[model samples]
Target chain A: MQRIQWFKWLSLVLYGIPMLLVLVFPFIVMVSTSFKTLEEVSQIPPTFIPRNPTLENYREVWNIIPLADHFRNSFLLGVGETFLIMVLGVPAAYALARFRFAGRQPYLIFLLVTQMFPAIVVVLGVFRVVVALGLLNNLAVVATTAASFSLAFCIWLLVGYFSAIPPEIEEAAMMDGDSRLGAMIKMTLPLSWPGLVAVGVFAFMDGWNEFLFSLTFISNDEMMPLTVGLFRFISRFQIQWHHLMTGSLLATIVAVALFMTVQDKLTRGMLAISEK
Target chain B: MSVVVCKELVKRFGATVAVDHVNVEIQDGEFMVFVGPSGCGKTTTLRMIGGLETVTSGDIFIDGVRVNNLAPRHRDIAMVFQNYALYPHYKVFDNIAYPLRLRKRPKAEIEERVNTVARMLGVQHLLDRWPRQLSGGERQRVALGRAIVRNPKLYLMDEPLSNLDAKLRVQMRREIIHLQRNLGTTTIYVTHDQVEAMTMGDRIMVMRAGKVQQIGAPEVLYNHPANLFVAQFIGSPAMNAFKGRLETDDGKIVVATEFGRFPVGDPLVARLKPDRSPTLGAREVICGIRPEDITLDDAPVTPASPQAQVDLVEGLGADAYVSLTIGGTTLIARTPADCPPAENQLVTIHLNPNKLHLFDPITEETLLALP
Candidate 1:
């Protein structure tokens, strides 16, 4: 057993070293570049780490871009869109989950069909509609549009979650002095919380990093989310590599934080879905 | 306690009639069980009575009041599902208290009642534990506790013990019967297991093909089944049925089969239709004999006794089931397990004519009753 354990650990280190290097190498290079002066960055051979690291890149990025406002806009839009997706998607998913009315199968098919078409195909029409509605440069409009684009996926994910709960549990509740609606609220919803969290986190990440819809719908700098705002760091005349790298690192950190907050729930949701 | 009456209750799901027109009356505090094979509409009937399913046609009355339009909660009934249906997320205390909470009972009363029932069920120690943390038997008790805490007008149980292991099933069966008796609560239990029906129910309702075949006490149904379905359904190993003909032999009625002619007693003669065909209406009648009623002897005592060849013997400790072939007909005789005759041994088996059941070939109705 001891020999086998040592061999297994040896193989694990051999396999893990390259994977770790590949993932961390880029972030390390970016951080090192962000800390270097323009002269040092332009050197023939790149340095893995700067001789002297400074916080100047972060300060320059914040000063050059409306980083605080952009961060606020991204946070607001992502949270709002994800919340709207859950609010609208859960009920629609539940309706498809429990009831058997006419056109239910077609309705589900229609929702799935929405996911089939890439966003680029409908971007023009959606832009025209947003312009007509006079919501072209509004963050609320951007959030709503992002929600509409992602709601289909959220509903699809939630449908699997809702349907995974045994119908008998609801029936048991109904028999235990509850109406159908009451039974759903009291039994099914509580049991499916993990699935809800999983889908919620997925929608959050999707909206947080979304580039196309935010770009097409919002043109104003104040309403520009982090994805679009990050583009301002690059120009034809000169590219501020340090600020861009710092901003990219910041975005990665934010997304990772959001994911880590709900990581346990995500694992539970996957287990729940697979078990069912 | 309340009397539940279903008058011509019918349920149709799209094109299939899950429950056909069926009528039954369950008296106050009576433990009525609907027992049948799968897809026999027993669970559907129980659901209809509980108002879980909408009635296609017919009225359901509780305490002499029509309740077909009432919701499940308004019907003031509680049900225990086969899978226990204890809320996996809720602690045992909350699960038993859910019904009372829904009814908006006083908090003190809910707590008191929950604790009382928990103690009664011997689950007080498990009150803080979630349902998934409990064993199958403990979960079953919690389910029962949830149903009983409310003191509802009726208790509807749908095969609650069907999920347990064999030994636990038997143990829980006795507990359920004792609980029902002590509480004197009207209950309607549904199960496909006839043993549960025979042991637990005050009256067993045998159903088949979305209809009630027979409704009687266990012993009554066992001895005097209303039809061939009930006879075959109610007994373990089932009643042995063989095709035979009813004939008048010297002013006495006798069942004539391919094997031989056996005299039917005078009590059964009046029930036989004289105008029926040689098959007792069509071409053959069914004769049912319980395994216990047939006896195996080492030698034939009289000329009329039939000689049997023992095919197999199943030693069951207290008794042995001996399969025998008489002429071309095969039958099983429950005999003493000790000193059972060896396989292929020739023996004289006597069929107890008094305990025989005769059914019409065409209608499958009981043509004669045992004395």
Candidate 2:
């Protein structure tokens, strides 16, 4: 028994070390490079940690690139798009989960078909539509389009979540003097909070990092989101390594922070779907 | 309090009929139960009356006023579901106060009613806790409290005690019966367990294949079942049935089954036809006998006795279930627990005439009693 226990511990450490390194190594490299000067970043074996770490690269990136404006734009667009997706997706999901109506199957199939198409294929058409609507330089257009793109996926996630809740709960509410709509609000919606959070976080991440739509729709540098603004650090001939690393690190930090906040909900939603 | 009447109620889902023209009158302050096997439409019928399910075609009357088109809330009925259906996030107090809150009752009145019902159900201590924090029995009491606070015209319970452990189910069953009696609310409960129906209902509606087979007081249904289904369903160790030919010997009728012959007393024998099919349907009848009705004796002192070897003995403390094989047929005899015969022990068994049930093999209809 002791030998087996020793072997189990040895194997756990052996497996865990590489997994930890793989996950943390990239973030460590990015953070270290963010603090290094342009000269230090171009060193012959890339330094694990900066020899003389400084906040100079962060100040340069912030001053040279409108990094603050990009941050604000990204935050606003991501939150707006995620909120819209949830507003439209939650009720649609509850309807699909609870009620049997005409054209329900066809509607679900159409929604699924939207996810099957690659976003690049429709980029030109989407650009044309935005231009025709006179929304080419507007952040609202990018936010709305991104939200529209994520709506189907969010609804799909929420449908599974809503269905996982026992129908008897809603029926019980109905017996307690609630209308069908009231029952959905009182019982079904609250029970599926984890799914809502998971979908919200996913839409937020997608909108935060989306590049093609933001780049095509918005020409004003001030309106550019983080993903598009980050490209300003790179030119055709050379890359500003310090500025690029700082900006990337900041974006990574924001994404990771948002994800960590809702990580429990995401795991729970995924588990609920898999169980069904 | 008001009586509920369902007349010629029919509910069809596509091509299948769930409740086929069921008609029942539930009296005011009476506890009525709809009992049957799964998919027998007992639940469907209850839901129709509760207005949870739309009636395909029927008239449902509460207090002699037709309520076929009324919403469940408008009909003033409260239901307790099989899973308890307590809102997991709500405290027990909030759950019990839900109906009153929906009615926009005064806050103080809601609080008083919620507390009163919670105290009655012995769940007053659980009011501040969420449903997930309570045990199964506690959750059930909160669900009951939620229903009782409404003081609706009628109460509908759909196997509310089914999810509990056996001991808790029995305890809750008694509590529900006592509570309903004290409140004097007309109730319509649905359950697949005949034991619950027999013990708790003032009258049980036994259904099969979307049709009601019998409806009567528990003892009446047990002693005089309307058909083969009721005869088999109501008893604990379900009534044993033997297929046999009915024959007249010396101007007396005898049912000659594979197990042996049993005399059909004069009144019952007259109900059998002499000329019957080779299927043994006319002469062929089913002899229904409860296990308790078969007497096991050491000696065959009577002419109406059949000899058999005991196959198995199940001692249930209060009674012994002895399985015996006679002429290639198995028969269960309920005897005194202390004097149970051993397996393979030879014994003479006699079928009590008064306890025998005769049914037409073809129609599966009870022949002894005419309705």
Candidate 3:
């Protein structure tokens, strides 16, 4: 290899350092704050590295609220919401890809329009429905609203993937002695593993990161998920940024772990991987 | 004996009729080829028989049982698609054994059958490999193996060799014919290539615009086509067709056209006589002659022979096709390569009187063959 050039180093310093600061500096701050004392966090000429690191915030954040309970609630809601979204999304995607009906284009456009609305708009409408159902403090309202919002986009993503698979594959299965549904399950599903993984990850991450619906629909302390639980560190008098960073890092770790588990299934698309 | 029958079957997709009222009966152990150009309803008819397509009208009988509403699975048939739709997830062995497994056959039996087929197709070494790993010819054999392993009553091959290279297509064509004969399953093969139909089919069904033009043995179709469409469709370089008008002088029928004034033979005269109608005479006609039927001559050897200027000569190994301009028309004559006419050289082409086909210009129906 050629020796490294001075301009290359200069470009790397100019471009890469700024990118690292913009993309990675926040996580670094979050991490350093979580291990610092409240006094050290607000100190003028803030330290890049914690001068004195302590685990006191972790212990305090865990004890100040039901951290484990909030985590468990978030975990359960994410899993349930993702499962429900997939159950609704996969079949809808298959139908849109394979069949033609009079209102199909309009229906698809309507789903896209629904996705275009900001979460601020969705949170209030879902809150109204939750209140009307007498479920303001219930986690079910949060999970349901999260799944509904994610379902539309998940269906559209899967429609593109499902349409990529040729119908001849399923028809060949049918000729080989499977019913229509049997063909789909045996042939289409296995071939669609990538799409399924992507949609599942999308829905799960959507639910896990949602703050608006969880905040609006869940006010009870026990029913609140990690997203709403993060705000418990904030009071009218002062914002406990260290405890907030601790909870946020813990949530990020779990999300990363979930993604790691399903990463292999996400590698291949429907018909492309099978081609020589 | 395996058999399939389509009685007045018709299929329509919205306003476009993919297959018109079609009738076909495939006999036991017969290789029936559906030959046509693209959009000629050949594949649609095959799909209808395979039960992949629902019939818009009429009925289908499989082995003498009316199977109007039977699913493809229950019809006891296997189809080799044009793309060789191998299951991407399954290994070669499992792909071949899938149909047997679906029938709840014993695992041991399934393996034995798969092994036998793989060995027969010479794909035993690739049994554990995915379809993507195989060559084009190997994939075709695997597809053929999958179809034959079940020993179903009927086999439908939809342009199965169309995806391969020219040499491989010929090899696979022979393999399929050999495989089908050994299996003795009634087969209906669809193809747009007339050469494939001519070489492999025991009997070819020529189709055009969703209608059956003619159905017969290959030689019969070559010798006597029912209409102008079949005449133009069944040959490789296609038959040379020219416009002409029929006339009678001194009890002899003569054709007058741009090509030349040529006297009609006895077979054509009997077809034009008073039997079909007393008032029908002096009608517009289309005359056809196969490229091979015309032979080049150095001089006028016969009273009816005509001379023309050679424009192009295409040499194809053992034979040569000479293009000649007779007045304003170009005629292709299949001559032996040894004596092909040089460009700009004048030559006479003597057409066979017995092989002349005359068709009604308007209706396009062959006038010579219809009694």
Task: Give the lDDT ranking, best first.
Answer: 2, 3, 1
lDDT by residue for model 3 (B94-117), tens: 889998999999999999999999
Model 2 accuracy (lDDT, Cα): 0.87
Residue A2 in model 2: lDDT: 100
lDDT of 1 at A90: 85
Candidate 1 vs candidate 2: the lDDT winner is 2
- Give lDDT tens digits, candidate 1, residues B1-371: 99999999999988898888888999999999999999999999998888878899998999999999888878889899998887776789999998888889999999999999999999999999878788999999999999999888999999999889999999999999999999999999999999999999999999898988989899999998888889988877778888987776766667777777777655555555456534343346799889998877887788776788999999989999988898788898888888799999989876677777888767898865434
Candidate 2 CAPRI level = acceptable
Once superposed on the true structure, which residue ranges of model 3 sit more than 4 Å away at CA?
A1-14, A262-276, B272-280, B302-305
Backbone clash pairs for candidate 3 read none
Q: Which is the leading candidate under lDDT?
A: 2
Give every collision pair in model 1.
Answer: B279-B283, B279-B284
DockQ score of candidate 3? 0.59
lDDT of each residue in A21-99, candidate 3, tens digit only: 8999899999989998888989999987899899998899888889888888888788888889878888898999988
lDDT of 1 by residue, A55-162 (tens): 888888888788888888888887988888978998899999888888999998998888888889988998899899888888777778778878988888888988
